[model samples]
Target chain A: MSDMSRPGVIHDLGYRHYDGLREGTPAIARTLFVTGLRHVYGLGRSGKSKVMPFLLLAMSVLPALIVVGVVVLTGLDSLPVSYADYTNQTQLLVSLFAAAQAPVLFSRDLRHRSIVLYLARPLSAPVFAVMRWLSLTVALWLFMAVPTLMLFIGAMLSGLDKSDQVTQLLKAVVLQTLLALLIAGITGLISSVSLRRGFAVVGSVMALIVLTGVVTAVQAIAAEQDADSASTTAGLFSPWSLYSGLANAWDAGIDTFVPVDGAWAVAYALVALLLAAACLLALVARFRKVGSR
Target chain B: MAVVTGERTGQAPVITTAGLTKHYGSVHALTDLTVDVGEGVTGLVGANGAGKSTLIKILLGLLEPTGGHARVLGHDIEHESQEIRRLVGYMPEHDCLPPDVSASDFVVHMARMSGLGASAARERSADVLRHVGLDEERYRPMGGYSTGMKQRAKLAQALAHDPRLVFLDEPTNGLDPAARNDMLRLVERIGSDFGIAVLVTSHLLGELEQVSDHVIVLDGGHLLRSSATGDFLQRTGSLLVEVVGTETERDRLGEALAQRGLVCRPRGAMVAIDPPPSELAQEGAAHDLIRDVAAELGLGLMRLQPDRGHLEDVFLDGAPRV
Candidate 1:
């Protein structure tokens, strides 16, 4: 089908100036947010980077899938585990995901000195810090949302009450978002500060996993010793305990070692919000200082 | 051969700084200095710790000057760094690429960071990569690239945004001889063919002689000289004579030339004569005298050549004397 007689000519169009619409900070932030989200899940990166995130993801989802299977085959009236309780049960896997993936978004650029490339007119240090935080928060929320969705679908398939399942699933979604925001702040702050992958991962694991474990153990001991206020106060020390305390207070079918009450519950919410805000402010300051020579 | 550089479309000097000073504790990284960089390829030449990198970072607005005023493309550096960032791109002196990403991905990301949309970022990344001669190798991860390829990738990202000006910080560092030549040629094309103004830095003064239209010499955080490249390579107005013998013959020739009237001295294996005396100022008078002196001494004269100045001469005795 080719014209054999005609000679092929390659035209050299010289370098042309760009005259198109150049977006501003919003567009730059959007692009960074999308890229950061994809990179955390190892979507746009090297093949080897996909292993740890996907492995952690699979491990987190497996228990929900098994729960769904059991409810479907036995034709139970309702699922054995509540949706809000699912994330708390998978806390170890969730903590590992945050620890393993935060470095991909935060530490690698600073460690490799590639963060300088992102400092342009539209993408300043503050905007970069906030967009990266948003990406990690959204990624974490999605990590919890998937299993909850599966449970909702499984419950619906087995003829559970639609309104009741929706209410509990909605509560779980809200709690997951709150939990994600706090954890993202902690991990992003740790990774940005460490600037070394191994140290960043270990620091995040200590903050999100080890610190939370200690808080939970202390809260359980306080509750066993008939100290209600101390147990409730200990739950405010970690992101995971705060999520569970709020869940139990809201009647989301989560049973905490000590029940969170009126003023203490308000303190828990305020601490979570203020701590996340403090982390973000610290990130902005860190980025601004690091951007200079 | 000199490259045919394009006009700068009638703009101010690409960069200007006045009384710029930077100090850390007691160490002065950049002292009270002032300079202006015009269009085309203006080479910032200095030795190590000569403040070349310090100057570039300050111009990019990434470092604050303790006291000074600077402007890039008419944008104030202190208050209007955002505007300067929009108009200029900087290829840093150190490694700025991650090992896991390919050149294509990284350039596209940088272009997007510069506010280009997705499709525009991709298109410009491809064009700039091909322009830097990384056509087929751009798809591989930069970790596997040679030093030359890494330099090219760095340049590609700087060019992807279509800025009016770019600052290249030691673009030929860590490159082999041939690769250095290639990189120089690419820097020239960015200025001449693409009509982009470039401010490139190098510690090697000789390398910029072939590509730079204007040269600025920095010595110990001070401005030694700033002028056109031709001025630094002018003829020294001295003639050198060599004989086909040992140092003894060269010394004898030098002594004989000096004994006669010409003020001559020994320069390595040659006898260097300052411009001949007024009485013997005829064009070839020095040549004839050197020839007769060598023949009479039973030494074969090998070469009689005029001495030319080099950019390196600026450092040897300081350009201030020159």
Candidate 2:
């Protein structure tokens, strides 16, 4: 006897062909920047990954909140805390944030050897490096700017004089942006070279914190010994001192952590620009050779 | 089937390298190697450190060659790498997936990087993941996946963009025998059914013989051999004849074939006959003689075929010891 014939079926899972517009390098860089920004704050990662960044962010905003509270309660016309000096006061927290988070943006890809996947796309190494640097720079800017924005909002709510306060706050925000770029460039460079997370975190923290401490000590001893040039040069070694020197040079009214004045101001500005450019160049070079081996 | 052979009548070469050399300081990773890869599944067979990965990287434009020039899909490797990368996909040999990301998210991100729009990336990622047989498990973190699942995830990402060409670097690296066979079948389907050119690498010589339309062997950073898979296993001028029943039946056939002035020997349940002398080179002479001998002996001829070469023979003969 013949067997019974069965009906056949075909499934349509909507696997459509994509004939849409394909973006080029700029769109790719933008996508990478957005993804990296989310990664920096642990947005797509596990819950455990969110703790450190949130904690550090809260810590950064605490002092600003307290200042704003005092201004609101006492009904002061002017903020007790100068906006420009807030970054200096909270430099440790900003440095810590950069140290802890730069690896999340830069090192993890290399450690997991995922850089190959990235480079295999229609992206170049230099573009990848620049996008990563820009993402961290923007993240750091937001990290510092949010608290400063809070202070501005508090002053406005308390009915402080509009023109002068806004002017000063705007200048402080500019200075903070510069400081953010400086920190991101240096920390991102260090993290790019150290693929191990623990090692990269330690290296970034030490480079930003320990080196600044040593430079500060040397500046202090040099100033006491009446060594003017030595103290000025000492201030050039650490990102914190460099930002402080630039602020002083720009006449921001914030107290300089180290004595940077006269011709030293131009020197400090030149050195900071050169240092940022150098770190960026190094990062590009590192990524260029990333998967070649 | 109209297979797309890169060097065949109408198809052009998919990849071409001329005098390609790479040096890592004192270590020469790839010597002056020149080769052409046609369409279809082309297997790249070599031992470990035989420059298989190096060649793939160079072809993908991920690594710069110290010497020589190359092109992929008509794009120059040196000047037009962006164009090359835009058209090709790569599945690296190492463990490259992030531990925290799900396979779906990662594949979608890869598709986006390949210039797909947001909606297209998501849709393509789903399609490729399903094609690679990663079901609901694709939504879980890749760090928790087994080795075979990870390989499938890598393959899905490589296909996420619907590339015209793909360089799969050891897709079956850690797979068991069954998984390995499945991966090979998928590779063959990619080349034949999907019409995408594939350059897959493996150290296991025999495994690729079944799937690859063409095989290229490399040894010590040099091109050892390149040819069609059938050419690599072409007939070796001998015939294998099997008869039904036990050794007695096979022996009777062998003895009768010998008595017919044809040299033959028992091989398991079959008899092997070497090529006859030049005087017996006339068409159908050897065939008719064997048929007549078997008929005279009343033997049941079960099978008759030419002895074919194997990939292992090529590897054993040409591959240098590591």
Candidate 1 clashing pairs, residues 3+ apart or interchain = none
Candidate 2 lDDT tens digits, A47-157: 888999999999989888998999989999788767877888898899999999999988988888889998999988899999999999999999988998999989998
Question: Candidate 1 overall Cα lDDT vs. reference?
Answer: 0.87
Cα lDDT of model 1 by residue, A1-293, tens digit = 35556679545677888889888777778888999999999998888989998898888888989989999999999889999999999999999999999988889888888888777444778888999999999999999998889999999988899999999999999999999999999999999999888999999999988999899999989999999899999998899999999899888878999777788778988998999999999999998888875
> Candidate 1 chain B: minimum summed lDDT over ten consecutive residues — where?
B1-10
Q: For candidate 2, give the DockQ.
A: 0.65
Runs in model 1 deviating more than 4 A are A1-16, A69-79, A158-163, B1-11, B242-252, B276-306, B317-322
Model 1 clash count equals 0
Report the C-alpha lDDT of model 1 over B168-226, residue by residue, as the tens digit. 99999999999999999998888899988899999998789989888888888877777
Candidate models: Cα lDDT each: 0.87, 0.86
Best of the candidates, TM-score: 2
Model no. 1, DockQ: 0.65
